[model samples]
Target: MKRSKKVFITLMLMICTLSTFLVGCKKNDSKATTKKDFNYYTAEKLKEAIEKKEDIIILDIQVKEEYDKHHIKGAMPTYAFPVKTDEEKKKIDDVLGKLEGKKPIIIVCPRGGGGAENTYKHLLEKNIEKDRLFILEKGQTGWPYEDLLEK
Candidate 1:
């Protein structure tokens, strides 16, 4: 082949390789994966789980006063309500460190609102699997099981 034809072929090959590489390196969204939200467990279900002695971790993120006033029994308190600041986020580290095993983590926020979602997202960022996390339905505010609460 002529030199020009050889160079042209080489260029085409390089372009093809580059195209393949770029396509391969593309950030592909998860396929067939459903968009996830907080897997909420009702207070009733939580009570049942407790009664059945099922393995579960209740992570309470209420402030110290609120938590002391009334909170779920056996809940691991981070005392980091709102969980907005880096320090408050760090507060959860103690409980997070102790969080092991395959038990589902039920997050007990004050109102089961943004705080819970934030904590959930933070946990995901900290390498906790989404499926293993749950937000207490309506949080502590809507929990009707007085017996389950530790005042």
Candidate 2:
């Protein structure tokens, strides 16, 4: 009788543990939304969006030198100034301020090689909703438009 009781308890515990893990897995699978969790779009789609004047911001996160060489017209250069101190943050704010209330701000870099993924997380940490931010999947170089302004 004692051995039987122990087996039953162990089985119950195993079932409970499995149930908890399943529940957690389910929660993870369900996609959650926030400004940081935004999806990256290709440049082709982005151009389409631009033509339609969609509510989005096309941001270039590359070095100014690269930007000066060539970039999509009207795209904002976000990392123009290095953010070394809190004062510099204000500069960032100034740029971000212009983009305030804008949905789906698309972050772009040279071939999508910049620290855009981290920046996206930082923006989310700042309470920017996930839906408000996006990344250009292929980036400026990958943009399929001949309008690429080259240096």
Off by over 4 Å in 2: 1-38, 80-91, 148-151
Give all TM-scores, in the order shown. 0.75, 0.63
Best by lDDT: 1
What C-alpha lDDT do the candidate models reach, one value each? 0.87, 0.70
lDDT of 1: 0.87
- Screening candidate 2 with a backbone cut-off below 3 angstroms (N, C-alpha, C), the clashing residue pairs are 34-129, 34-130, 34-131, 35-129, 35-130, 35-131, 36-130, 69-151
lDDT of 1 by residue, 1-151 (tens): 6999999999999999999887766635433222256688889999999999999999999999999999989999899889899998998876777777688999999998888988988898889998999999799999998988899
| Winning candidate number (TM-score) | 1
lDDT per residue, candidate 2, 3-89, as tens digits? 999999999999999999998887788554343455778777888887788877777767778888777877887653334446544
Candidate 1 steric clashes: 0
